[model samples]
Structures are given as C-alpha cells and as structure tokens.
Target: MSNNHLTREELQDYVQHVFGASYLITQSARIHGGAQKVIYKIDCTNGFTCMLYVWDISSNYFQEEILNEPTFHSSYGSELFSLNTRFLAQHGIRTPILYDLNNDRDRHSYDFALVEYVDGQKAEAYFQHKNHKDRDELFQRIRDMLSNMHGIQRNVYGNANDNSKKAGPCYQVQRLDAETALSYASKHMKDIRKNDKRLLEKLCELEAAIQPRDLYNFIHGELGPDHIWIDHAMQPCLIDIEGAGFFDLEHEHSFLEFRFGDFYHYLKNNDLDPERMTFYRFCHHLSLISGGLKLLHRQFPDQQFARGLAEYHARCVVQMLS
Candidate 1:
C-alpha cells in the first residue's frame, strides 16, 4: 500500500464492488507516464482486465478551485476520462472504454477512473522498430485520425467541458484571435520570467507579425509520440485525451511539426501557412517552458532533472524567437 493515494486493499475493494462479489483480484501493476496522474492495470479472476487512473489532486499542478466546481465532478472532472474517450471513439478513433468513475474525495482524497486496458507498445517505441514505408503509412493513419476529430465542428472556440448533460466547447479563457492568444502567452512568459525583458520583446515582435485566422476545430492539445499507441497490427490509437478541445487547427499542426520535424515540409506543401505554423510553434515552446518552470517550482524544487527541463524549454523558446 503506497502512501501516494489509495491503499492496495482499498483499491481491491473498489474493484470488487464494481465488478461484483464473484470477481477476485488477480494482478495489479503500476503503469507510468504523465507526472500528474497515477495509472494501475488490474486483472480479475474472471479474466477481465481494466485500468485505474488516480488523479493526484494534492499536487500543486492542479487548480483546487477548478476541481471543486460542481461541473468539475460532473462531465468536466474524472468523467472527462470517459467523456473524451467516448467522443474520440465515436469519430472512429481507438481509445479505452471507460467502465466507471469515482470522485468521492471524502472516501479517498484522489479521484479514480476505471477503463479498458489497451495492449500495445507506445508509438515512440513501435516506430523505432518500423521501416520507412511502414512509418509513412502509420503517419498517414495518424493524420487521418486527426482529420476525423477536426471534422466534428462547433460554433464556439475554447476548452471542451461538460455542458448540461453532454460535453461541449466552452471558452474558459478567451482566445478568439492570434493576437489575443499571443498576448496571453506573452503575459504568462513575463509572469514566469520576470527579469527576461529581451525575450519578452522578441515574443512581442513575433506576436505583432501573426495574422489571425478564424479557423476553429477540435484539437488534441498535446499530440506527441508518448500519447500515441501502436497495436500488434500496427494500428495507431491516441490516448490521453484530457487536454483536447476546440482551437486553431494550425496549433495542432504546428505541434505535430515541432515534435516530428519531418512533418514540416509535408504540412507546408499542403496549404499550411509557414508563418502561422512558426507562430504556433513559438506559442507551444512558451507553454512548455512555463509548464516546466511551474513543475520545478512546485513539485521538484530540488531535482536537477526538473531544473534541466525548464532550462532546455526556455532555450528552445529563445531559439524559436531568434
């Protein structure tokens, strides 16, 4: 029983209660990835397998006020683990099937989400073993999946949150245009790096040059190798749908470019504006730097690795601006 959250006994009891009295716990293993959440794979005596995601609400990364919101407990909270999964699944995207969600903080300080266990290697590892032709096919499939999600249009632009009985797009922060988004990023950078006026000015110049586009589409906020999983059949399935929402299509494309440099030329030739992509890339870099610094300040103030990441992302932002 680790002190991080629920004890092994408590978890087993919850699983048994959810699965039924006939089901017995067979195995449990911790799966690692994101820093803010803890995931466990649980197998039952009846041969049923499921994933349990425990959110660490005590972490400094989470906003307590947001978590405390009534809607947060509804479609917007741990339910998002299920909501987003179903939303993507409807678009022909492969994602885990959510079984249940428990947000009884009084019973357990952390929130828990039970989902189907996916069997496959992460896309990052799978790609290392593939040939060029195979990798190209996989990339195409990924693009197709992105296009499918983007095809689901909404009139509003913002984060996808629980609206009434269903998940809908809602702007928690207004970013109606390129300039407004850039201004938000600039202010964030200034707040995190108070003494770095030179970098702020450079960011401002980049912001000034951006031409706002009114295009809005559903975007996977964090699309990288880590979140993509490839099954035995070489089919790609996207996971970690937590940060997904309606935003500029260019933002998603730019992130795809930043993470995989090979995509830059392909995107540029396919009608994606070079300057818009660059501006979004800069915004992504700023976000990475800001997030890294926050992690360093709150969770790992004494860890050299956290400090190194913060420095690396800051350097990337500076280089992008230059």
Candidate 2:
C-alpha cells in the first residue's frame, strides 16, 4: 500500500486473510469523488462483486481540529457510513448493503467497508435522459423517501452516534437550538474571516433573526447528486452518508437547495416556511465557507485555485445572508 493506495496483491491478501477467501482477484477499478474517501470496485473469481470504501484519515481535506470537535460524530469514517446505511434501512430507505468492515490495527489502520455494488446510472444523469413525466415520478419517489426519513422523530439533535458498538439511542450529540447552532458556526467563522468585521456583523444579524425552537428529525446531511444512485428498476438508493444524523428538518431542505439548484424553485410550491428555509440556507452556506477555508488553510494555503474556491463559497454565504 503506497500512500494509502492498495495494490492488487495487498487486496488479495486482505481477501484471503480477513474474508477467508482464496478466490483470485479479477479486477479492481478506482472511483473518484470527494477527497475525503477513496472507493474501489473489486471483482473476484468466486463470482463476488463489491465496492470498497476507504476513509482517508490522513487527508487534511477537512481540518483535523474541526473534525475532532466534541460536538460532531467522531466516527465519520467507514464505521459511520455502515451505521448510517443501517439507520436508513430501518426507515425503509434503500441504501447499499454493507458486507464487511475491516479496522484491524496492524494490517490496515484506516477504516474500510465492503458494500454490495448497485449497478446503475447516477440519479442526476438518469433524470437528465428521462421524459418530464418520468422525471416527476422520480422526484415524487425521492420526496416520499425524504418524508419517510423526516417522519422518524428524535428527542435530541446532532450526531447519530459517537461510537460503533451499540446501535439505537446509543449516544447522540446534545440537542441544538437555533441560537446554539448559530453560535457554533460563528466560532468557526471567526477563524475563517479573521478581520472582516463588516461580514461578521452581517452574519451576527442573520443569526439574531433566527427563532429558537426544538425540532429534531432524521437528516441525510449530505444529500447531493452523486450520492443518489438510481437502480435498473429506477429506484433511488442513497450512498455516502458519513454526515447523516438527527438534526433540524429544515436543514435538509437547505442542503437539498444548496446541492440541487432547481430544488429551491420546486420547494417554493411545497408547504415549507420560506423564512425558516432561508435561515437554514444561510447557516448551511456559512458552515461550508468556514469549513472550506479551514481545509484550504491546513492543506493548500499557498494554492490560488483552492483560495478562489473558498472565496466563492464565502460569497455564496454572503448572498444567502443578504
């Protein structure tokens, strides 16, 4: 394994030792996405096909200090992905079935999960080729799935679990009201925008306008296009759920609009509170800007493109706040 890249021989050894399988490895293809995780499609001679996800623990894509914050889920690695999959499954939501998890200290220190491979086009691409009626049906199906997920109520808000042992009601992050959530974002923003007093004051005004309330529900924290895969039967399957948790339901709509630009217009006809949605959108944009800056600072401080991207996200936050 060179710099966390697994070679064919190493993968075969893992299959033999961990899985107790002597089947010859046929093919392994890497799938690229966000920098935090590495994915591979592995096919074996034993007629087994699976996708392997390896969390890049060594990558400073997200600052170590921010990720290690006590309020967030600590196991935002392979273990959390598996747990989130199980959580969604309990709610009748389809996700990639996790086959096995390997976290051995000696062999491979990084977390890894082997999951059933679902062969189909990504939902975004699938929707683009479909007729209007079919696209509407797909959107309805997605809406129903989101409704089912949000239907599952939770008493507290925040990370689903901190550890991997016990499943339900195991250990949740403390409930967060609007004030508390905004305060946390403010802390991060201070570091990202050190001397930008004008921008900081605008952020404070946005935070003050938020009305504190207790609303907790299951939220697929990162419900972006790439994570939604459409199967051959045209059913939606959710993947890459490292950020899933129990949180404010409004945040879900915020994420949906942020990731899918058209969602904002679609949701305008729905029974959602416009002001609340706007507030959540502001919060989400601020979080992304702060988090992106921290990642750039830690990993690519001298890179101009990286700095530009961070500035772009910050501009989005400013627009939302306005």
Candidate 3:
C-alpha cells in the first residue's frame, strides 16, 4: 500500500466497524482513474465486498489554488455525495448504495465513504466486445435513463446543495456562462489562437448566436460509459454522480457526444438548441484542454494520458476555429 493510502490494519478496522466484527478483510486493491479521490476495492472473509472512497489533498490531482472556483461544477465532501445519492435514488436512477461514512476526523484524517461494491465491468469496456444486439439493448436502456434524467426539471438551476435559493423559483442559470468560460478558456487558448489568428473572434461570434432558455433539466454534468457500470444483472448503474445537477441539457449531451463518439446517435435527442449546442461544443473542448493541462502541470500520476488529452483537445480547438 502507498504511504498516502490507508494501511491494511485501517481497512480492517473500517470494515469491522461497518460490516460487524465478524467480517474480516481478505484483501484490498486500489482502483485507478479517479483523479479527485482515492478509491479501493475491499473483499472480506464473509464474502462481502465494498468500495472505499477517500477524499484527501494527497489524492487530488488538480491545481488546488482554483479548486473553489465557481465555474467548477464538480462538488466534493461527504454531505454532497450523500445528497446526490439520495437525489438520484429518489428519481429511480440506479446508483451504488452508500453503506457507511466517516466524515469526522476522529476515525480518519480525511472523510471517506463505504459503498456497495458493484460487481461489473465499465460500460466503456463492456461495449468493446459485446454483440450488436447486446449493444442495442444497452444503448436503449441508456437512452431511457437519459430521458428519465432530463425529464426532471427544477424551478432553479444548479445542484440541490446550492445555497442560491433566494433567487426564487423560475430563476435560470447556466452551468458555465459564456463570459466566464471565455475568460478562463482564453488564457489557455494562446497557442491555439496562434494557429488561427481569428480564433477568439470566431468563438465570440458563436457565443453571440446562443439562444436563451429558462427551464433547467437535471444533468449528470459528466456522463459517459466509463462513469456507467453494468452490474451482474446487466442493469446500468451510474457512478461518480457527485456532479449531477440541474443545468442545460445541452451541456450533458455535449459530454455524451464527446465520450460516446459514433454511438452517441443512440442517445441523441431530436429537440436540442442548435445555437447552444454550437456554443457548448467549444466550451467542452476548451474545458478539456484546460483540465488536461492542469492535470499535467500538477504532475498527475498518469502524466502521459493527461498530456494526450491536452493535445487531443488542443487540436480539436484549432480545428473548430478553422
């Protein structure tokens, strides 16, 4: 085990506290790909398995100076996770059941949660080898989930934990406004702009064409096959749902299209704001470029992958400008 991660004895203590003293930890392994938190899979002597999520500064890979920036949609902390979990469960969306948590510093130095260990493969991995029929069935269910999720509209925009209620019902908000997005993205677009001197102008032109809307639909903020799990029963379970909230449906669709690529058609909706789509499409790539660079600069464990992402999005941004 790494020095930053919990030791075997600590794991045993946590498992014993939650699953009863009779349950003993058989083994524990770290799950990769989480840049914000450390996740581990724990197997117990009683044949029980669960996931441990640890939120500490050591596990985070992003630049800490801007972690609290309002433009960042991802929420943290144990309370937000619990809130999002209940929010999804109330909507009949499938998600991991949170078993227990220790947010108080007494039990652990940092907040952590134990959730039901889903015995399944990632939807992204599952898609690679599945037959066409199986793929269709899976995509159909995913489309249904999208419909059910987007159908949930809130009077105001933002996450359920947001404290902007004083704005009252009928208040509308964008996940990231154009001005703020441009301000943040422009700083990172210098190299990209050099490729096309008028890049910023073109982006501004696209931004001006965006249409406005008042209704806010529930969105996963960051949804993709990787964040989805296919359990033993072949049902889809949404993971990393802390970013789920009420925002522009287009924001969610933009991410789905980017992540799912060619297969996105299966989940695409006929009615979407074309102008908003155009604008958000740029925002999406810009965010990735900034995020990827941030990760690389912060010396993320997967530096090569982060650099690849940054390069990929950088190319996409230049091409879009053209």
Candidate 4:
C-alpha cells in the first residue's frame, strides 16, 4: 500500500504505452495509501491533465477487475465517469473519470486504467491535520453527504430483492435465512468470534424484514476516512469506487457506527425508525463479523480492523437495544 518506484524512463514508457507517445507530455506525482496501484499525475500538451493509475498487478486480480467492472458499474455503474454523475453523484463523491483501460494486456505483469484525476486534497488529511480545528464540522459534512446518498430511491444492483447477485437488495445476501447463513459459515469457516454466533441468535429471534426501494436505499458498501477527497472549496468527495457496489442500506447505517466510533447520531440523522433501524443495524454488524470469520478461514487472508471488531460492536449494539 506504499508507492512502488518506477524510473522516469519507465514512467514515460508507461504513459506512451497507455496514451501513445506523440501527444503525451507529462509530469509524475504519486498518490499513497491502501491503494494497490501506482497513481501518477500526467499532463498532456493539449491542456489535458489526467491521472493514471497503474497496477503492477497479479493476473487473477487483473482479470477479476476486468470481468467485474460491468457488475460494479451496473450497480450505479453509470457513475464511473463524467463529473457529478447521479446515482452516486449529488452526494459529494469524486471518482476518477475512467477513460480507458489496459486490462489483462500482459499475463505475468500488470494492468492499468486511465482516469481523470480528481482535483482535491485527501479529505482525511484536512480533517486530521494537527492544526485543523474543523474536525467536527468535517465529520458532520461527511455524515450529511452520506445521509443524502442513502436518500436514493433505487437499489445498488438491478435487483433490490434478488439475492442471487450477491451485492444486491436492501437485504439481498442470497436471500438466506439467518439460520442457514450462520450454519453455512460456522461449519465452513474459521477465525470467527464467539460473540457473532450469539448476536445472530438474538437477531434471528426478532425476524427483521427488509424492504426494497425504501428511503434508505443506497449504501456506500465501504465508508471510512481512507476513501475520500476534499475539493478547493473544501467539499467532500469519495475517490475509491471499487467497493461502491450495492448492499443492504443497513450497511451504510452501520458504516457510520463502524467508523465514526458512535451510532446514535447516525440513527438520529436519518429520522430512522428507532426499532427497525436498530434491528437492521444488528443484522449488518453480525454479517460483517461473519464475513471477517470467513476471510480468516481463507489460507491467506487479509485481516482488517473493521472486520475484527465487527462482532464485538454487534454485541454492544444488541445490548443497547435489548
């Protein structure tokens, strides 16, 4: 997740390779974080300035992205480019204006995608700066934007109630009943917390029902400080679009709780039905905890903090409501 180095010649070759040599005038700057690719700032002589993200990638990941791009896009896929596009537009999101792809060109090497650089500083940098006193205000702004996004009327995937798509619905999740989901995971998975199983039992007793196309429809899928930018006027914009697919809106509701260190205000902001929202929140937390356990079961898995604490927090929420 750190910058991998390439010589100026290599950069030039890459630019030329992606854009063709004659018209490609450029300077290179690096973007850093949990990002998997090399992001460079490229300036062309035609007054065209764009951002290039290259993945010196593994073939498996490369192929997956190429094949999955359409599915991602289809879940508000139209928002892939064009400034201020809807579906995921209007909510202060800024994503690379994807232009071209060099997908799966080389099997052993890497793949690259070209996009217009989002113009802004990382939102977290501004908010977390030692001297910045506006941290609370920035948080509120982000909260407002997310609340607005959740205001969308459509589901993330084409089918809001269909579970077959994996990333659809207000409660898609393959339309599994609580028992089946838990049984499948417990028998087939590992690295799970004991608390998750307990939480699921409580949730299943309540039998929360999901509604499609409700006011709280859209979900960010992933929401944390790492995936955003702030424009010149200090507007918040989301940069990472990889996890911007569909899911239960409860994901977004639980998202604020998961990252913001609190859940009360998030519930308040949406004018949420206290009883129903609380139930869904429990479901979301339990699901994430379950997911983390399954990931841990994988031979080589990425153990993330969010995933690790999911079960613990789910229990806390369950107790609060109970």
**Model 4 pairs whose backbones collide:** 73-77, 160-169
Give per-residue CA lDDT, model 3, range 1-322, as digits (tens): 3324677788777778888999887777888888777888888787988898888855677526236665455555667778889988898998899999788888566889899999988888755754888878887887888799899986568787663643532211232433344455456657664654355576667766766556779888878788889887778888888777887788888788889988898899879888777667777776677677778777777999988887798787778875
User: Could you arrange the candidates by TM-score from highest to lowest?
Assistant: 3, 1, 2, 4
Which parts of model 4 have CA positions greater than 4 angstroms off? 1-14, 17-93, 104-111, 116-133, 140-144, 155-169, 172-197, 209-216, 231-233, 245-248, 262-268, 290-322
Tell me each candidate's TM-score. 0.77, 0.77, 0.88, 0.59
Q: Between the candidate structures 2 and 3, which one is better when assessed by TM-score?
A: 3
Write one digit per residue (lDDT tens) for candidate 1, span 128-237.
55487887787677767767887776655655653232243222121122233333335545533553555556555655566655456887777877777887787878
Return whichever of 3 and 4 wins on TM-score: 3
Ranking according to lDDT, highest score first? 3, 2, 1, 4
Instruction: State which candidate, 2 or 3, has the greater lDDT.
Output: 3
lDDT of 4 by residue, 1-322 (tens): 1224446665566667766767455566665433234567777666667776665533122233335434222222222323223336455444555676655555325555567666667654653456444655665677677667666554235333332433444343422433443443455334223444564556654444543453335555556555667766666777655445444455555555555554235334554445455555665555554444544443223456534554564455446445
RMSD of each: 5.3, 5.5, 3.1, 6.7
**Residue 18 displacement in candidate 3 (angstroms):** 1.5
TM-score computed on alpha carbons, candidate 4: 0.59
Highest-TM-score candidate: 3
| TM-score: model 3 vs. ground truth | 0.88
The lowest-lDDT stretch of 10 consecutive residues in candidate 4 is 72-81
